[model samples]
Target chain A: MTDTITIDDHQVPFEAGQTIMEAARAAGLYIEHLCYNPAYQPHGSCKLCSVKVDGVIQTACTMPAIAGQKVESDSPEMKSRRKTLVEMIFAEGNHYCAFCIKSGSCDLQALAYHLDMHENSFNHRYPVRVIDASHPDLILDHDRCIFCGLCIRASRDQDHKNVFTMAGRGKATRLAVNSETGKLGDSTIAADDAAAHVCPVGAIMPRRGAYSTPIGERYFDARGIDEIDNASGKL
Target chain B: MRSTTPQGNCDVIQREPGQKIRIASCSLAGCFGCHMSMLDIDELVVEVVHHLEYCRGPLNDVRELRDVDVGVVEGALCNEDNVKVLEQFRANCDLLVAVGACAINGGLPAMRNHFGLTACLKEAYLDAEGVVNPEIPRDAELPRLLNRVRPIQEVVKVDYFLPGCPPPAAAFTELFTALIEGREPAFDEDMVRFD
Candidate 1:
């Protein structure tokens, strides 16, 4: 049997263990995803990567690739749904990009641009959160966290430090430190930890790296994030 | 292609046929980044002049406002003068297009919105590390400042919005083409920016 699947018309070949997203990405396709880091297993935290497989919508990261399965992405309807997802996430957080250290490189901001979120489809919630600067080398600005679980996955799966965790229910839910002191400085998280480097937003930042890269020189400055299709690149 | 009204020497318009469109522009409490970006259209300005004529803006030395077919406004409304200029543009133009992030959501100037007006003034005039005179300007001749900087939509009805720190020149080129062709201007994902 041919180990190929059709995604938005292109025939993508896949290996036995690769997920639909992994296969599509390997074939140089850009699927809108926020939470599926290649280093970690697919968590499916953000549903922006939803694609139609055999006329049913499914998250691409968790779906396994199969030969002859027809997958659809980049359709106007799918694009609209992805746009709505981005808008909802944006409204739920207090992400002000102008002053954010990760302004140019923020994944959420880049996604918003990619989806053409010209104006807020929903009203700005303006919810405020505290900035946790207790960490010596890294500061956790809770306001910017979209609760995507990248830090949680990175800390636990990659660092094996379990320095971060989720707590509370629904709206009250938040990213929390695992230390008894409830402060990042009190935790074992170091500036060099892989978890500290994995935040897609400005939430987890090294103290002195802000503004090190000048504006217009950073990612997604003059070009869209999808301009290049590097098979090994992280979106 | 412009022709002055022989009767009303004050009013000048295109002498050509009914195809010419008048356009005016204004800059508010901003760094004029949008204007610079517009100028980046380069030699295409000659082609643009063939369709649209300047009414009142820094593009010319004219210090007065005139009736126009379209008004392209940039920057945030931060002071009383900005409000007056915006109202003038609204009153004179048939359509108003808010250009750039400042016109869309108040942009960087609206960063002051997080802090109250008094606190911002105090920090800038009295409390800043390098401040010397430490006096908030209260001259009667000066325009009064707004409590917070606001987007153009906050002050007047905006027909369209082009979002960017300074939207790329290609965006302006596309917008002008659409407008000149009598179609609704559109911005795709490639042309808009949040940061």
Candidate 2:
């Protein structure tokens, strides 16, 4: 008998060491998330994937899947909470989606659309951040960084370059380059590095290729994130 | 129906049977792209006109903002005049709808929020390449610039928000048709976009 967990009334089978997120993804169920990419170790920083497991709230990416356990997601309460989390992320960063290069393909923007976040409920923090265009091929616009640390993990674990790191503490925490000058140009990150491609927002982007794909042809333009995620079967 | 007075007092305004819904619109610190999109409703304008009475919008030249059923606002509040106009719309209209991305999240104009007001003014006026005579305008008649550009919702209560760069004409059609037919307005997934 397979160990199966019920998520939003859907039976999702899981292996012994699998988390609820992995189980749900394998079952072709889409759970909204930002910091829980399957390419690296799950980091439950975003809290957008908070689910009710046996009537208790827990992060789906970190919570272990158990047989006969019922997880509550896709409910109105859960959706609303996820929307508020997205709104807070928008409020914290200077995400002007109107002109952002990653407006269409951005995971944060796509999740916002998927969660039906129409207006930001929180006041805009408008934190003053830097835009590092020092790299020959990449531009780091810190204004849009959500601090998911996907780049840090990808660089350290996958690329073995250690090009990125999370510096400071609390609200003052920021993405820092591992170089003497504290600039991306001085770092060993390449344009093809996994760290360069793992940014979920517009914070890290390759230069000279913006808006290459027209508005209607972009990802998330024709399909919602849920549909795309289900079709791709990736976490 | 109920309306708010300029003094911020609620007043009952009786609407006669078979009366058309009145609408007013304004553009502040944004481009008139949203108004252009509203106009792109094209042939549907004839049908819309039958149900709505234009009071003070780009379609009409009326300067005074009269009591209206819906007040559509486009753009962010970047100056004192924009703030005054938004307050006036809030006072006069029963339902205030933020029309586009500018009114909802400050859009492109709010990009100035990163640089301080002095820096922006200096860049535009004093540091530009074309320097015949660079001087920051400080005329008494000119509306005083706010320290930061803000979305309309930051200044007044907004009942509805139509998100997009300039919300697609289909979105307007949906909203207006729903309003005219006395149905609750809800956007399709494709209709709501930040860009």
Candidate 3:
């Protein structure tokens, strides 16, 4: 018999090693998340995917799928908690979505839309971050980063370049390059590397690649993130 | 209804009776796109007109800002004029609404916060690839620019914020409807489209 788990009352079938995120995605269910990728081990960093697992709050990305396990998602309380977490992300970074190249298709922007974020209710940190334009093919705008560690994990875990790491902690934490110079151009992050593309926001995007797709024609334009590839963990 | 032109019976303009919600709108250091989005309400603008009267705005040439029920300010607070306008909104209206990303968090105009005001002017007039007397414009006629572009909330107490470059038209409709009905303007996920 196929082992199945219940997520938000939907019976999701999973393999032996599948996490709740993977099972939900396999069943075409959308569990809001940011940092858990299927290509690598699940890392619960964003916490936007936090759901009630057997009546306790647990990250769906990290929780292993147990047959008949009850997972509660999409509740009003869950949405409120998720909204708070997303609000914190907006507060942490100066996410100017208006002029951003990744404005239409950005996952963070899409998620913000999904969460009905009409205002950045939290105090705006307005951290003056650097816009690194040194890379030949890519640009890194640290202003919009939420420090989800997707690039950090993807760099070391999948690309094997060890090109990204999180330096500092708490509010001062920032995404850093692996090279001695600490610049993206100085690091081994190529334009096509998995690390380069794992950024959920506009922090990492190809140079001059923005606005190529018009406002209404981008990836997340007409359809939400759930419809397009599950957007599961930058995978 | 108010503003209705009486036919040949009389030359009098019969205005709407009773208490109509007063609205005041302004565009600060912005592209005036939000106002355009406001107009994008299409035929539904008639509904807004039915409920509210324009006390002061670009939609009409009304100059004086009376006691308004709602103040809609669009764009970032960049120069002295912008500040004056924002303060006027606060003093004139009971509820102040920041209508776009620019008003909420500085938006595109606030991109100059990174380069500083001096560098921004120099880059535009002096450094850009151009040939001429590339000098920054300085005159008493122009409003004095602030050190950094600031969001409207930083300058005044904003009651609500509608996020977007210029926010969608539907968002404005929802907010207007909610405000007209004396309910809180809370956007659901389906109504949020930042682009």
Candidate 4:
């Protein structure tokens, strides 16, 4: 049985096993999501989708909407909190979008634009990451990694190969190659493996025409992912 | 498909393709496009060459394989020979640069380290190709190939890394000029894909 949940002053229906994110989307609400790509399973790592569920700030992406639940998807307090959260991600990682190959076409960049995040609020977490180019078809630049874990799932599910996995814990958690020697190039991953591709950031990109997209003609402005998503009936 | 030049060498470069400083390099076992991108600098080639040397064609007038001021090395060190070639340039050149995705991270060639070398060689030459005898040759002085390719840094340290499939030629020219001027290269932080 699906019933409406009291959210703020309005009532939004909650369906069984319906994630708050999906319900909100169905109710015509835009929640900030970067790592929780619909193509893959919901990865609530970004924490940008945090909403006040029954008066507690919880990740809406992972939490299920329950009956009689009081939710606050957008509020002045939530807006600032979400903006601060996004700023933290931006500052923590070296998200210099202008030079990035994924600059224009990146979801993070689009979200930043959507949220009006001009200045990074958090201090830069200058993590010295290793660049793994072991796979001939793709490159792994950890410096550009936001810990989205899209590649990990794509490798396991779409490619039918467990080539990429998360290693360590907390801030130390990083994407590690499945090689016993702890090297990606040495892994059994083929050139066409999904792990070798599908990097949201330039952290994973093709080797042939590396930055061939040129300056003025990047992914975002050139194609406009929002327009593309709308055209593809995704957004 | 890539074509060879009339001179029997792979003619991957377009002749007089503008005035850009051309650096013909190779990525053995690693991605080979680093050198190809140098030519891909397209119309910017001439502008880039205006700032540096356009060393192309028969290494004749170039004379002596003396150390170049700025050398771009792509691919990883899979064998001793790869190490030697990289080492020579590192020691001889003023600014030994590692370009392309391979030289930066061992790239796709390094993926072979997961499986046995025998499996990889067999799959490529014996299983797929039209070769009769695929076993190791007796008189082949081919240095022992490693089970995987590694970034150039693992074998020999590099002064700079111009990453990408093969980093854009604009980057090469900018980096080369910056090093020559004894200045830290000014990269448009917006231009590089840090992720």
Candidate 5:
């Protein structure tokens, strides 16, 4: 028996428990994703990699690609809906592109621009967000955070230290520091932790060079990140 | 249906060489970042001025107001004065534009609303260390603060909303062109941010 699946009319083999996104990517099919890092477990929050599987939009990162399963990626309807998902993330979060330290290079803003988000179509819901400056070497701007949980899962699975946890629910749910004092400084996590750098927005930034990266050479446009092979290059 | 003609019935008259339009802008109870972004229009500023009237404001040089075809309001109503200023702009100009997040959704400054106006003012004035007069002003003439700052739409109906912390420069250009052409505003999909 073969562990394989048919994706977009192509029969592709996959390992057991492998997600449709991973299998598709392995087959050289590009699926738009921001939250799924190959180096880490899927954070499935981005919803950008959503593809029609059995005629339903589901996160490819978390959803397993099965045998004889059908998948669609390049459809016009899928493209439009994907763009809307990316836009919703831009609107829900306090993604101030101008004031953001990660402006040019930030994944969130870059993805938004790439997806062609010109105006915020949704009625603006400016939720009250708090900034955490407890950690001396790292800053956590909750407003810019999209709750992707890359940091949270990375800290637990890779670092062997569970430092960050989600607190509250719904719009009030926020990433909280796991420590006796409930402050990031008191946590066992280090400034150079994989969790710190995994932040998509300008949320968890190194203290010293927090805003040192100039506007032009920052993160997104001309100064943007090398997204092609960042996992292997930086890791 | 205030204007079936869209914006106004005025037609673009032929102008001699170097002739420009006049424009006026203001920033009230909000960070002037929106104005900076407006000025960031760079060469487009010259183009905007060519077709509109421009006037300097009583406060900042960048801030201005004049009787013109369009009046841009770049802040939310935090007090009675804001209401009056909005009404003045609405009355004086054929078009009123709310620019940026401050003008659109009250921006970060409106975050103070969670604390209420009195507590916010008290925290800055009375609770602070060095102050000539720590006492809250008992004057009746001065405009009293609202319970909370709200978007311009809440106080008065806004003609157009260009939402962003400061709207993207590209959208700014498109909106300006649309306004000048007397066409319905174009909100490019590229300018929309949702999250």
Candidate 6:
């Protein structure tokens, strides 16, 4: 008999070593996350997937699924907490969705809409950051980066380029390039690398064919993030 | 102008027995696109006028805001004059609604927040490619600019916020219809958009 875990009252069977996020996702449940891509190792940085397990708060992506565990993810309290997390992400960066090419397709924007986040409750930081446009094919706009480390993991683990790394600490932490010149243009990352296409926001963008698709006709325009994720069976 | 019969019968709209709901709207440091979207509510404006009185707005050309039931504000606070206008709206109106991305999060204009105010003024007046007379304009008539552009809620309490580049006309129509009926406005999934 397969051991089962309950996520929001739905029973999900999980194999040994599978995380709660994996189990929940396999059961066709959406837990609302940003940093927990299935292709990479679980990164618990973005706490948008924080859920209560047995009445204690835990990150669903990193926590191992145990038999008879009760996970509460879609409760009112969890939704409110997720809203605050999303708001902090917005306020921490200069996210001007109006003009961004990634407006309709960006996960951050889609999550905000999904959570019904009308206004950012916190004060805007408006931090000044470098826009690294020296790269021939890629433009790394640091302002939109949420520091999720997806690019870092993709470049290091998949592409074997080790081109991206996080530098500094706390509010001063930033995505730094691995070249001696400390610039993306001087790095070995290629345009076709998984790192180039893995960013959830507008931080890393290819220079060519940016505006080929109109804003209203893009990914999240026709369906909410949850609906799309459910239908596609991927985050 | 007064008309007893509405252009089209709207069963959802209901007004107080004797008093018409007074409304005021303004555009601060914005492009007035939110106001344009409000106008894009189209023929619904005909029904809106029957139950709501335009005390101060682009529709009525009234300068003073006083004793209004609702105040619709667009744009962020970029200058001293904009702040004063927002304060006036908050003081005179019972309910204040932020109508767009600019009013809620500083939108496109807030992009300048990354660059300091001094750099912005200098770049515009002196460092730009075409500059015959390089002088930062300073007159008592001109309102002083704030150090950073901010949403209206930062300066005053906002009862509601409709988020969009300019919230779709359907969002405004729903909000107005709900308010006129004395019910809380509920936006559909498609009605709330960031871009």
Provide fnat values for all models in the order shown.
0.29, 0.57, 0.55, 0.00, 0.10, 0.76
Kindly list the per-residue Cα lDDT of model 2 for residues A39-61, writing each as its tens digit.
88988899989999999999999
Q: What are the DockQ scores of the candidates, in order?
A: 0.19, 0.44, 0.30, 0.02, 0.16, 0.43
Clashing pairs in 6: none
Candidate 4 ranges beyond 4 A from true positions: A6-11, A214-217, A222-235, B1-195
Q: Which stretches of candidate 1 lie over 4 Å from their true place?
A: A2-6, A11-18, A64-69, A91-100, A167-174, A214-217, A221-224, A227-235, B1-19, B46-50, B57-67, B77-92, B116-150, B153-159, B177-195
Among all windows of ten consecutive residues in candidate 4 chain B, which has the lowest summed lDDT? B1-10
Estimate, for each residue in A90-208, the C-alpha lDDT of model 1 and write its tens digit: 65666667567887777888888887776544544445467789987888988788887888888899899999998987878789999988899999999888899888777888897
Error of 1 at B172 (Å): 3.2
Q: Each candidate's TM vs. the true structure? A: 0.76, 0.94, 0.82, 0.50, 0.74, 0.94
DockQ of 5: 0.16
Arranged by DockQ, best first: 2, 6, 3, 1, 5, 4
**Candidate 6 — which residues are off by over 4 angstroms?**
A230-235, B1-16
> Which whole-number lDDT from 0 to 100 does residue B139 have in model 4?
50
* Residue A217 displacement in candidate 1 (angstroms): 4.7
- How accurate locally is residue A69 in candidate 4, as Cα lDDT from 0 to 100? 83
TM-score of 2: 0.94
Tell me the lDDT of candidate 3.
Answer: 0.78
Q: After superposition, how far is residue B122 of candidate 3 from its true place, in Å?
A: 7.1
Which of 1 and 6 is the better model by TM-score? Answer: 6
Q: Is candidate 4 or candidate 5 better by DockQ?
A: 5
Using TM-score as the yardstick, the better of models 2 and 3 is 2
- Between candidates 2 and 4, the one scoring higher on DockQ is 2
Cα error, candidate 3, residue A129 (Å): 1.8
TM-score between model 3 and native: 0.82
